[model samples]
Target: MAFVEPGVAAVEARQADRAKIRAVAAGRRAVVIGAGLGGLAVALRLASAGWRVTVCERYGSIGGKMNQIEEGGFRFDTGPSLITMPWVFEELFEAVGERLEDHIQMVRVAPLCRYLFDDGSRLEMTVRLPDWLASIRNFEGRDAAGFLRFLSMGAAALELSRATFFERSPWERPSMADLAALRRPLPLRTVLPYATVVERSCRDPRVRQVLNRYTTYVGSDPRRTPAMLSVIPAIEMLHGGWHIRGGLYRLVRVLGALCERHEVGIRTGAHVERILTDGNRACGVGLRGGENLPADVVVMNGDAARLPRLLGQTTASAEREADRSLSGLALLFALRGKLDGWPHHQVLFSGDYSREFDDLFERRRFPSDPTVYVNVPTRTDPSMAPEGCEIVFVMANAPANDGDLWDVSMLGEARDRMLARLDRAGLMSALSGADLVAELTPRWLADSFDMPGGAIYGANSHGPRRAFLRHPNKARRVGGLYCVGGSVHPGGGTPTVLMSARITADLIGKYERI
Candidate 1:
């Protein structure tokens, strides 16, 4: 054959393939397994695209990890305290011809987090450059410039990622814009490990700890995480952290509403036992009680590691304990009286940050001196509590190992360690008359979400390949099967999960539609 331009030939081939896909009418069915944010968002998108959609959730309520609890007039969000990249969410509403502002209010939280160091020193981290730089100068005058340079590098990574990684799966054909982004000169820091970059960029250990904490946002260890993951902090510094008026769970409610408006059906207490396939292509699902629901396409919103079990494979494809991400132990408190002088979010650092990660990832146990994170949602929204009470959420990172049993005694020890960290920061006294409403241990996360070891974001984003080469949205060996949510491509977080849904819906439009 005579040589033709490669791009042109590829376009011709895609066009020919498109012509072969038969057009189906409006009644084509889609089954979404799980009612998490990603599942609900894709269900809304497909339903809006004229395909009938049904979402089956194993739990009685929607919002998998992004759940909520209300007791004695106090409400606490179980997962994801705040959201950044608000525009990512806005796009989803815009896609379905709805306005996000009309449905929910996004309140910007100033001084995103209050960091309490081991020596009782406190600093407020904000997006306002002048104020933050001034604070940095007070702590370590030389680090101010380094901090700016680090953030600058992160901005570049975010720019490149938006053009490529965030747009589509790695297996898909890249647009010219994506290829152009790839050609751009990358920062030297982007090639280094995240922890190494942080240590090199800051003189003070406190600042390094603050910057290093970003890696844990995706359930990764900073020492091994790739430098491109710097985008996490860059996003927060650029867009500012936001909280819905009610709670982060409000986002799930808004997504559920959008799905309902598009005529999508949501079935709770419907456990999908297996993914039913016909001749290697996903046709529907088998419920736990043996009810078979047929559909043209199936999307999994649970942990990607559980896909094989649901497909009836003899051997498990679950991530190994060494490869799994960190899980958290959370203690939700409902205080009896008013507690002032606390921000919406605070991080109490451990004396030795490196050793803490060693305990979490290597020792495979809760840290002996674990860093504790405290979030008092009532600080931002008083409506979350009673007139004089507040809801306090205290959490610490723990290993996501399957064999570990977080029994009552184990939970008590973890709680004590967490409270001790808070006490050192002088915030524990406020909980003198508090009620411990609930505790979410790693075992609870594993059992409740069907996640292996309760690995929140599936595999840890360690090396470059593992960080970027995530499970694709479309399954290669299984036709008509797709994956979405925090565990899949584009990775986790509220905004990224929504992006995953958008990408999955577009792929279905391409391969399953004419």
Candidate 2:
């Protein structure tokens, strides 16, 4: 999948870009940087529209964060273990003359996740409302109805999501008429911090704590994350959670295949050093090896923080301006035995949730008592693990790659502290004998994924207007330069990233007055 290089490849690249935009244009071409999930979706969309799309990935394989790690016959998906909204993926296939059911096998994950609190009480949040109410009704009492009412509000919010709010490009500042169409009042409180809404609806302290963590999907502290993001509950509880058979990477494989099927040329090991531009319009990109790849449209699926450097222009970084989101310390283990009490997804929450966030975000230090997310993929996909062995993925929220606080030398000590948290949570005995496959730090994530500061969702979604804080889908100054990924509008997570691609691709088709 290497980009064809040397003397003539550069010449042909220039000609192809020229002919696409200038000629009869049936052979219009698109060049995509970074073949991550968003890039792959964009490529497929463009290819389906009769554009000659070329996706160049720096990684050896596609699937940026949706990477797979195999160790001692056990397989683990490094990023995004749970599939929240299946319809998003299905719609992607439907757009490209294919059906998702034909490509991937999916199994419903009942009892979506298990939440273990600091107190000895643990609650299993099921996809079915009856089962969910059965568990929480005791603590929530009459207020269980309030929780249901909150979800109804979230479902109504989805109507706005389908319109301009989520579908419209971030570059276009919405007018008063636009807000009217959304039916939101002036000076929108919908963009207010998520804590305001959660505190009003949730009666139980534990329920509020679990709901607050949903803000991490956009890599924001609960106190700062927007209330519009409350739809996360409806997305999981109503639609249900699912796991792709084989592994989550299977989706990436199918996407790559779909791109190829549509004649979208994919190149591996080609990293773009700079985006080549002709005045206001982007004409091409220059690879690290000094190779030029010209294109009519350049879709950068990389981090928005890299935009200034890639353009060779001096501009303020969206990352530096906004609070960068929290990063993670991931520990993958290959264990021979299984624990008696385990769910597909488990959250062993910290005793003091607010202090944990303060430690990570405000103090810029590791959490003294962190909420740990333990995922057992083998619960549904047994084939991922050998005979009796299981692959365990343990993730704890930590500060991003702040220059002073995090470094490789400190990773060992951090891993010990994380495992100690597990011990305190009462699951250390099961993992004590497991073989450690890898210990990854934020710096490693930064280098590996090209994330500036290794911040998971790019910018932290804080402040009064979370909408204006995120990077725009299209560059304000640079024409023909577009961005699609977790960092852009609609926020982070697999479904939203895919939605960004859909939105960006649609915007690319519209002609703007200069």
On TM-score, the candidate that comes out on top is 1
- Candidate 1 structure quality by residue, lDDT tens digits, 311-424: 998676545799988899999999978777788899999999999999999889999999999999888899899897889999999989999899989988988999999889
Top candidate, metric lDDT: 1
What lDDT does each candidate get?
0.87, 0.78
Q: How accurate is candidate 2 locally (lDDT)?
A: 0.78
TM-score of 1: 0.95
**In model 1, what lDDT does residue 171 have?**
87
* RMSD (Å) per prediction: 5.7, 7.4
How much is the lDDT of residue 279 in candidate 1?
A: 91
RMSD of 1: 5.7
Please report how far candidate 1 places residue 455 from its true position, in Å. 1.3
